[model samples]
Target: MEQWKDKVVVVTGGSAGFGKAIVDAFAAAGATVVSISRSPDEHGGNGERGNVFSVQADVTDDESVAAAVSQIIQQHERIDVWINNVGQSIRVAFEAATMEQYRQLMEINFYTAVRCSLAVLPHLEKSSGSIVQIGTLAARTGWKNIAPYVTSKHALSGFAHQLRIESPDNVHSLFVCPGPIRRDDAATRYKAQSNGLGDAASTPGAGVKISGLDPEWLARRIVTSIEKRQPELVVPAKARLLFSILQLSPRLGDWLLRKFAS
Candidate 1:
């Protein structure tokens, strides 16, 4: 908490989901939080700490994103940490989905992070701050349905790695990969987007055999990781074994998945 007392943190898509959880966590930790979302009205009131501010911006628009950064810098004078947490996911078979649909989802899930991160990077560099890129297990593992989301995350994972490799010692880019985040409507969140995938479409990660993580718990871990300057955070720690296996050999990874499924 003390670590963030004097810092200025900016979170994109902080109106809901993991983004909102992260905003609350940082505010509780005493950091001045700026939450930028499309519908800032829906973002509601500030946090209990009275340190949260909301900004409405279309993250995919270069000018909108730049203006939001300008506004934050003008008001706060500096940015100590910038978090790119805005993302959307959909469930559709690769064949059933169109290139246009894929592009649209990419705009929300991938390019939003790219734009927000690039816009705030100079200020973060000035403050020797950190950049947090929220990702999902989809970034590492290829699951049935949701090729667009999976491909976007894979790009994000690569981007985060490049950022970390290129960032100065004092600046850090943290990539977080977690399983399904528990949501109130988790059971049917993807009903309309399912494209006839049935029960699988109604579940997170297309009913991947994994537990949905509590968003609040994951947010807390993210806050601590920022303070520790951790490069990558994989929740349920044991999940890393699977990611490790996937990387070592695709054949072995498929065998393990098949074994686990059986």
Candidate 2:
């Protein structure tokens, strides 16, 4: 990957999970990392590196997203990378899931990304920056009990596809579909190191152990793709083949998932 020295990177949902990993990766690559999330204090990047900033914002709210984006632009004057990582997952069955839960999931997983993209598109277009939306394997596959979560991701994936085609100049739009990652472990380590709060598995779909990839390694791949301006990427080599095969024959994929992945 090209050196990110002096670059400005903004990561939403940055207080935890893949968002936190992406922020730290960019910071380590020498970018000025802007951590945007509702709980900025939770993952406030320590000043030891003198390159990380935390901004409080609710991505699902357009005003909040716009305000946060404005603040970043005012402080840094340009954004080199904008990562949409805010999302939520619940494992309730389609009929069992409450209407409110479905709406909330859609807001968090899909609308938030749309709102953030609108907030930053002008700035990103100006600088020919990159936009990365964190996705999941569930986006392409069906989950027995997490219908809402899967549906929301499917919508987000479609939105990312549209954005890539519409974006002008070198303004690259990419989506990352990764499998389950061990968030609690990272959270414990981060807290112990006093760098920031670690990510915990809080969703209804939490403990389902699918094949997991290391966050650090996935972060490296994401950085490399962003630098190269690739349109989409899947973490871990296995995911690419699985995603392709699943895409071609979803019914068989769903059957296998129900038979074994459950």
Candidate 3:
């Protein structure tokens, strides 16, 4: 905890959900956390000028992201951590998904991270900081009826890997691959988008048999991983079996993916 005291941490899409949990966790660690949100006033901050500050920025737009990064640099001087946590998910079969949907998902889940990472890379280089990509188990493997999401996250996972390969030794990249996070709207958020794909298609994780992860606990684990400079982390740990099988035998991996479906 003392290790993070006063360090500048920036997280995108931190107004709510698991990203908000991350903001709270970093603040608890005594880091000066700047949470960038598309709408910062909505359930963002308490108006207390504490260790956490919320800034309004649309990460999808390069100019908006650039402006937000500049403002943070002017105010904080240096950024010790840049977390590309903005992500979106949807339910649609690859055959039914539109090019527009693919573009939108790619913009939100992939390019947002790329823009934010590029915006802060120089400052991070100066501070010898870390880049954290909040991804999911789907980033490692595929799930049904969410091909665009899986595709976008796969791109994000690759970008994180390339960052590790190219970044200097002082700069670290942490790619987090967690299981489905429990949310109140999990049952219905994508029901309308099911497109005759059935309830399993609408369900989070594409009805994968894995239990939902607690967001707060996941956030704490992420902070700890950042501290350890762990390159790639998969929650529930057991899920690593799928990635291993996929590498060793694609046939067995496909069978396991089908077997894991609820």
Candidate 4:
């Protein structure tokens, strides 16, 4: 945290949820946090600690993303860390999800990260900065519902891996994979509406009581990982083992997934 003092940090989709937590955490740690979101914060872009600067940008649009990055650079002159945290999801059966929905999910979840990463690459290269990509557990396995969301995350995971491989030694790319996260009120409402189709269309894991990690805790861990420059951080620790088991024993993995879905 001490290392982040005066650092310029940009977080996309930082107005709420994990993005908001990350923005607040970094701001509290003395970094200049710039939050890029379409909606403006109620506090007029200033965070609780008065270190967050809000910028309105549609990450899905290339020109908008480019302009946002340019504004950040023009103001801060350098970017120390860029967190690509914009994502969205809808719960529905794979067959029920339309191709249009899949494309929309990809644009919001995958393309935003791609556009932002490319937009900031030059500045990051100059600063030897870090790009932190927020991923989901769905990326590691095939889930019952939310196929489009899972597919988009899988694509993001692949992109991040390749980017890390080709990126300069000085520039670091890290991905954070977490399971079902505790949602905020707005997110809960959105999920409810998305699941309103019928009982048959209910979200997978609807009644399951799976404990979720706190956004603040996850944010702190992410900040610490960024400070340490770790390549990847998977929440709950057991997810890594599950990922391995899924790779090595497909039948067992399928059984486990079925149990989870049940």
Candidate 5:
């Protein structure tokens, strides 16, 4: 944490949820945190330390993302960590989901990270910085409904794996996979409308009984992981065991998932 003092960090979709938590945590740790989102800050300005900055940018638009990164670089001169945290999900079934919906999901969940990483790579290389990609348990396995969302997450996870191999030794790429974070209103609504499929609220752990994690706690863990330059992180600890079990015995895993789904 002490090492992060004066470091520059960028978080996309930092206006709310996990992104907001990450932004607040980094800013409190004395880092210059730049938050990019489609919405402007209602508070208008940085935190008390003047370390937090907000930039309104639609990450799906390449020019907007590029310009936002340019502004951050001009202000801070370098970026020590870039967190690609902007993502959205739809709870509709595969057959019910439109192709347009799938394309939109890809743009938000997969391509946003790709574009941001490309924009930040040069700065990361110069600073020996890291890129933390927010992944989900769905990336490891498919779940009921939300096929597009799950697929996009899988794509991002694959990208992160390849990125780790291609990126310079100094530039680290880390993937954080967490299961069923506590649902907000939008998520709750989506789950309610889902076609008898389980979601974060009704099935908080997917196939397990564990509750969702608090955003702040997850954010702190992410920051610590970044400091250590870990390759991958999975929340709740128990999920790691489940992930391994699924790999060794997918049939059993599927059975458990079905049981939970029921």
Candidate 6:
């Protein structure tokens, strides 16, 4: 679909993984991609085969996020899609996880998205732009050891749902919740299995061991959903079934998660 062609798109956490993939896909499809990340990527300015713009911003920092949004507006005049994709997690037992660690995760995963959404809401409303939130199956299924991550994702989904409820006539808010993908970090961590904790995402492919939808594939789905103006969608196809089953029986879903989430 050429709906994204020539459009202005902003992706947070654009330096790597799914966010980076989304930026690449949109740029390749002819959209002007503005990438927001904590640090400037080595490959940021090149745009390589497509149009890519990099904006260094820490989603946890309000001023930084605001400046990045301002820069995008100054350059693009309007934003056609504002995607909130920044997320961070620390795997730790509930008792072991310090309050500071919990706060850190919340700041990055929940508050960051909130700040970005608020910053771009006016722009998105003006352009009738689409707001896509990159969510996780963790939001649906809570894990025992990762309470902080679980809670943050839960909050993220809650925020998205609230936004959907209050969405303007022109603007659309979509949440793309995908299950765990084969990430190299997760795999390596799984291999190491110290204390039975799986995976360390110290590099690319760190999260590739688990079955996952290709980032590019997910991005295409996002684009298609935007064209059709879908409210929210689960990626990898299987997520739809899981999403339905979980929604139908939340307690059962939680039981299954607790059973298998080792």
Summed over model 3, clashes come to 0
- Model 1, which residues run further than 4 Å from truth? 44-49, 258-262
Q: Mind giving the per-residue lDDT tens digits that candidate 3 earns over 73-163?
A: 8888889999998899998877888999999999999999998999899989999999999999999898888989999999999999999
lDDT per residue (tens digit) for residues 1-262 in model 6: 3766668999988777778778877887778888887765544542433478877787888898889888888877989899999887655656777889788888888898899999999998989998988888677666555678778889999999999989787989998877664454554443432254444332222232336567787877777787788988775565566557778999776665454433
Task: Rank candidates by TM-score, best first.
Answer: 3, 1, 4, 5, 6, 2
Model 6 misses residue 207 by how many Å?
12
Q: Residue pairs in steric clash, candidate 5?
A: none
TM-scores of the candidates in the order shown: 0.94, 0.85, 0.96, 0.91, 0.90, 0.85
lDDT of 4 by residue, 1-262 (tens): 5688778999998888788999988987889999988865533653334777888888988998889898888877889999999998777777788999899999988999999999898889999999989998887878766788889999999999988998878999999998767765533444664565544234333322246678898899998898888999998787788789899999998787666653
By lDDT, highest first, what's the ranking? 3, 1, 5, 4, 2, 6
Model 1 compared with the native: what TM-score? 0.94
Q: How many clashes does each candidate structure show, in the order listed?
A: 0, 1, 0, 0, 0, 19
Per-residue error (Å), model 6, residue 143: 1.5
Q: Model 6 off-target regions past 4 Å?
A: 41-49, 189-210, 236-251, 258-262
Span of ten consecutive residues with least summed lDDT in model 4: 200-209
User: Residue 211 in candidate 5 has what lDDT?
Assistant: 66
Candidate 6 accuracy as TM-score: 0.85
Best by lDDT: 3
lDDT of 1 at 244: 92
Give me the overall lDDT of model 3: 0.88
Could you tell which candidate, 1 or 5, scores higher by TM-score? 1
Off by over 4 Å in 4: 41-49, 190-209
lDDT (10s digit) by residue, model 1, range 1-262: 7788879999888878888999999999999999988864666533223798888788989999999999989888999989988888888888887898789878887888888888888888899999999998889878777888898899999989989988777788999999889999987789888757767667876777778898999999999999889999997688789889998999998777655431
Candidate 3 vs 5: which has more TM-score: 3
Model 1 pairs in collision: none
